[model samples]
Target: MTDDTGYEFFEHTADVGMRASGGSLAELFAHAARGLVALVAEDSAIRPAETRAVRLRAASVEALLRAWLSELLMWFDTDRFLPAEYALGAVSATALEGEVRGERFDPARHTYGTEVKGVTRHQFRVEQRDGGWTANVIFDV
Candidate 1:
């Protein structure tokens, strides 16, 4: 994350890669969710008109990260929810509980640059360095 507590997009051949970092794991994961939002819409314009509690279980932190994003993406594609703010409550290597805040994706009001079809495991990672934490994830466009 640079100026904002957010994530950055990396150039991928046919998809997109995200590098999310923060002072803590919850922050990093929240930024990662913001990264996914950045991939689809303008975060600043998205109003927190609704909130959805997201819960997931995984075999590892990496899997949990992907599952979290995947659940959000599923909401976008199926439930039409476009998340902007992430309120990560409890998170561990195997479990996560969080709430995503954003209203349903209204194409008339929201500006989406691209359509992220799915999240991929390729080059997916979650690591904690001495200073902070970071994660890398790829998305299928």
Candidate 2:
């Protein structure tokens, strides 16, 4: 379970499940975003050719994280954006904002993995334990 990457993937029947942990909630969310990118494109294949701002407000931390990741997925589904890097500007229980750096999807360069349709509400969780924060998310791939 300790890949030293701060994130890991777990088996699921239909969708994919991911767990990301860090010393802080912000880092946990950042790693979760990275986990999503790792599932889509190879880390080295994606370049920071463009930047986009992400902002979301939810009722709780778990909801906020889901919305943030779902918003990124929307870019890929709608505009073919593939984000490989993220800079978290702000992350809180009720709101989140960040800057994502990546380029338009290029099949020739980027290696696509599971195509995540959406973030699921089932089996989703966010909590703090052992001096760290953890976020468990499932994607409708």
Candidate 3:
């Protein structure tokens, strides 16, 4: 369940799942965004030439995780800004604030062969384990 970069990745029947541990909520959200970006593009290869602002609120940490991913998808749909890197200014059980950098999505520049239809509720899970946050997401890949 480890990718070539050594980040653990688990592929289920529908989508993929990964785990990242952080000392703070901001770091955890940042890492979670990184993991999601890796699912579509190479983290290092994604050019950081554009910036975007995002604000999201949820009822719980698990909902916040889904909201974060949904916001990324919205940015991709509207601006074509594929997220390469993300920095979280704040995060909590119900809210998140962050910025992501990436190149404008160009079919020539950024080739995402597989289409992610959308995030799904099936098997969706997020939890805190061992003093760290873990998110299990299933997308309609």
Candidate 4:
């Protein structure tokens, strides 16, 4: 789905794809994370009442993106955590450190969306072009 935000979802064969673009790497990552959250739960229903610290390392930017999204997915899978805000302290080609602020899922108060089983590497990419960063990720439902 296309929106005013820097992120949009595309139709995949049996999955969902997300494309996010931003002026910087950190902004791009944040937009990608937001897209993932949107897929798992309604963003408007989440609250920034809790904070979770995140630190990840990978061999490349593509791998880092996968790890970042996977960590977020893990949180959702384990505790039904839905992130509302992302405060990235640092983002590099191989590492990322940040804090995600959000609350756990409460059926009475939150609206659940699709159940994202995992982040897929198929057609996954993170690239910088024309002074901007763009990321394309597909989630398996």
Candidate 5:
């Protein structure tokens, strides 16, 4: 991440939001993942031990932002995997593919821990930027 006024993270009443600026759509999505994980744990501390596959569709960028964060949360709820790293394999006008890797949550390993209730729409936003796109998304933790 650079300091070109590229991205910023904001705290909301019940969730966290991030506004990312990049030259491409993939960069924005990847940064958003990084921002989301930053809310839960240090990005450097999270180690990838397993790989998972995910697919999603949304009518708009805002909806996609919600779907993206919710998908990450779903991995925690269903697979117990904490996503700390994201590698966006493909990105299209309306779709994306990637692998999110992280170690399974362990009581002993995770600190400052709080369960993420869900991804919410209270303060969600995603839109085009000067070069590409920027998204403001809120997630419940």
Candidate 6:
């Protein structure tokens, strides 16, 4: 996938890989989440008509990222939600609190993409470099 939001998808043997960078950890997380949503459905077709609250904590940044994406995937699996907008109120190395706005999937109005099964730890990483944050995540498709 290609986009101007500091995120990109890379070819993986049996899965999908995403790399996202941002000036802040919050932005990086948001970009990664967007990438995940885009993988499930055409992001342009998703609308911010509903909102959901998110609060997560982990022992480390990498774990936090995994939890964050996993939460989003859970929402999709349970409610067919596709988030289009993100409002991260607080973001730290091990905690994140935010709100995501989007609507449930509508097959007639949305183009379905890959069905992501889960976020994997293979080559997964979140780091701060050159005064910015970057994350690499792999999704089991």
Model 1, 2-117: lDDT tens per residue? 44755888889999988888887788888888888877886547888898888899999898888888888888888778877778888887899888888887878778677888
Report clash pairs, candidate 3.
none
Query: Compared with the true structure, what per-residue lDDT tens digits does model 3 show for residues 1-141?
Result: 223332356667656656554556776677666666666654436787888777889998888887888888777678767877777787889988778777876766565644555767876776666765556666666
Report lDDT per candidate.
Answer: 0.83, 0.84, 0.68, 0.87, 0.68, 0.90
TM-score of each: 0.91, 0.91, 0.80, 0.94, 0.79, 0.95
Candidate 1 segments whose C-alpha is farther than 4 A from its true place: 1-3
Model 4, 7-122: lDDT tens digits are 99998889999999878778888889889887888555788999999999999999999999999999989998889888997998999998999998998888778999888999
Query: Relative to the unseen true structure, what is the C-alpha lDDT of residue 105 in candidate 5, on a scale of 0 to 100?
Result: 72
**What tens digits encode model 5's per-residue C-alpha lDDT throughout 1-141?**
234646676756655556766677777777776666656554336777887776777777667767787787777678667776677777766677877777877757775445667777765666775667777666666
Could you tell me the lDDT of residue 98 within candidate 1? Answer: 80
Between prediction 3 and prediction 4, the one with superior TM-score is 4
Residue 96 error for model 4, in Å?
0.4
- lDDT per residue as tens, model 6, 1-141: 236777899988889999988889999999999888888995557889999999999999999999999999999899999999999989999999989999999988998889999999999988888888889899999
- C-alpha-based local distance difference test score of model 1: 0.83
Positional deviation of residue 16's Cα in model 2 after best superposition, in angstroms: 1.2
Instruction: Provide the lDDT at 95 for model 2.
Output: 87
Off by over 4 Å in 6: 1-3
lDDT of 2 at 121: 91
Per-residue CA lDDT of model 2 for 22-141, tens digit only, reads: 887778887888888888775647788899988889999988889888888889889889887778878878888788898898888878677888899988999888998888888887
Name the runs in model 4 displaced over 4 angstroms: 1-3
- The TM-score of candidate 2 is 0.91
Candidate 3 residue 109 C-alpha distance from true site, Å: 3.5
Ranking by TM-score: 6, 4, 2, 1, 3, 5
TM-score, structure 6 vs. true = 0.95
Output the better candidate (2/5) by lDDT: 2
